[model samples]
Target: MHSINIHNKSGHDQTFEVHGWANNQNITVKAGQTSKIPAPDGSSGAIIALHEGHEGEQVEITKNGYGGNDFFDVSNIVGAGGNITAMQVGDQSTLKGDPHFMQDMNAAWHKASQDTRNKLKGFVFTNGQGKVTRIGPIKDSPELEKLVRTFANGKAYVGVGAWNGNPGNPDDNAQSSAGHGNKDILITYNDGDASPDLASPKRESRVAAFEVQRVQVAAAPPAPPANGPGIILTNKSKQECTYFFYGNYWNGNGTAGANFDKPMKNVTLAAGAKSHIPLPTTFKGRVQRGTELPATWVEFQISASNDGAAHGDISLEQGCDGAATIASTDGTNRKNGFANDVLKDAPAAACAKKPNGTKAIATTVGNWAAGPNQAAIDYLKKVVGQKKAYIVGGTGTDDVASKNKCLAVDMY
Candidate 1:
């Protein structure tokens, strides 16, 4: 005996017991309800149920509240310990029309019955306007027909294969060597001698003569930068366009690399138009000398306007300071030198270098180990200090030195 369980969205569970041969049995559940059907033990049968249809082959079990219904087959559920689950079908009305229909057809082809396939044969595809411009059977359609002809005739044919003098077997030569010296020219001949009055003309088939065309489109321009001294604007359109620039600045700590508080504005430009505006050279406050300013990169940005006009924004990193000939190409390499002067004065220009004779400033303040004995010294210092702390070490002979230092510092 096998058991089938059906669950509905209304929290109702229905179990059906199958003793044998259950075919096309219809089980109806309420709208907005989920159903579950389990396979019968030691029994093989097929069952049919109404479900909800969606964009793809997926079907949902729903009560009457939903719009459409679908049919599902469960013939292969015999001797299975698991139960088949069912749920209320959801709505798919928001999908775009063109691609969505195509996708639906593709899914239907995979899950369709023989009757469905035959019915689809009569259905025609059309553009969004709903005009039936395409014709022919699905398998023998112009698109697939062309591909088939190319595969049949080595040299590519429109409709049928050309005779290469290999007659005995339509696919092979009569005397294998008989057509060795035949010319490699495309020739079309009568399929048979039934119409002997007219000589067959040699020509490429219609299927083989079609050509595919591909067109290239231009891409849109990039967005303008966001942080710099001057207002930078960009046109988003593909054609030559102009944009307006308004005054803009970071509201917070005018640190050289900090992000601006306000967002930039952008305006559209007509083709062949250009807009120019003056940049702000100096920031509002006298940036203090001693305390380090917020690390900010410099770039340009357009100002926001009340009228809702578009503006461009640009931002640039400050140049390196302190160490002469320093490499500040990326964030990882831009470490602080010995004194605050080196890191503090680093340029706001990205990937920029400092002049020679600049002082070294320590960008990072934590203690780091260099040699094998360094870990030992670090451990000793930590243990000797009055503050509670943790000691971590890597696995290596150098770790012995760290252990010794920890013991000496009473950190062990």
Candidate 2:
């Protein structure tokens, strides 16, 4: 049986302890808001004591100050044998007048038994001005013999894979050398020539059962559409359409010439005139319409006027109007020539056009495809009767056509 779960997504109020180095056994998780622990037949490394900010502060891994930010889970221990033995015990008042942790003399404190060497040797803390720190006599120290030559000689560890540092407090745009919020001490075996010396303070070795996982930090993705869904092109055609070129004009001759182009600057609406085109507020697939290629929608070619010299060559079925040029790539070639029963009361999922198999709904303006400008011939001249033209190369015609203004017609 092995279990440990403590999730306090932080809002303050947290205190924990779960030590267990090779069965010394421990469990103390109390801080209202969340905590749990269970380990019956497993444990070799686990020490996560924190008090870094309020709650008796005083624990600084290095650099800044203010302690209490911890995480040590030896992922299930076992490693330390090339020459293991270290002892420094604690409580010269949480030691560290220049000390770094070391304990393990002669196969476990010399087979203990002097009252378990005076109640299992020392280590007591409470500093940051509140006083009270300790570290015992495992070897008449001289400042731990020059900090045991600043340790660097191998096999003597204390667990949590011989833990290391980076315990919070970096501010100013996060920088513990750039590992972010940081906490990752993972090592598995061949622990030779360790370091941080001090004889046997390999993070105070104790391993048997290990697995500690708590990672919460991810939330940012929601901002697009600041202004892009307005389109209304009504022109009820009286005979005039040009203002094309937004994309897809390969008229460079391939696939039998007239590849596509028309509709562009002729200016002659006298019958209904209306324009308000603005469709690319982002997030649809591939935009960049000033085009040299990048385009997922937008293409409106017109013909009924030669003054513009047939713009890009005009041909998507002789420049849209009486409909029939549908080569589609799914966006139903932009709902061909609209006027779907004049939107009889609208609504059919708000009609993005395309489906006139009878719910008589059809709408879509700026995002192109109703073909041949003047907002698709003024929506086929305000529709009063017989209308259904389908252009892109012909197929469904009975005369009168025009439609395109879908994104629910925002035009603003």
Q: Which stretches of candidate 2 lie over 4 Å from their true place?
A: 1-234, 237-247, 251-341, 350-387, 391-412
Candidate 2: tens digits of C-alpha lDDT, residues 1-412: 3333433333344453334432534333332233434423212234333343211111112100001111111111121111111112211111121121222222233343566444533422223762323222212333322232234112221212111221211120011110111122211111122121222233331211111111111122222323233233434535553323232212111111111222222222333555544543221111111111111122222211211100111111222222212211112222223432334443344333222222212222111122123332344334421123322221223321121212211000
Q: Alpha-carbon error at 137 in model 1, in Å? A: 14
* TM-score (C-alpha) between model 2 and the true structure: 0.16
The true-structure Cα RMSD of candidate 2 reads 27.3
Clashes of 1: 70
TM-score of 1: 0.15
Each model's total of backbone clashes:
70, 61
| C-alpha RMSD (angstroms) for model 1 | 30.4
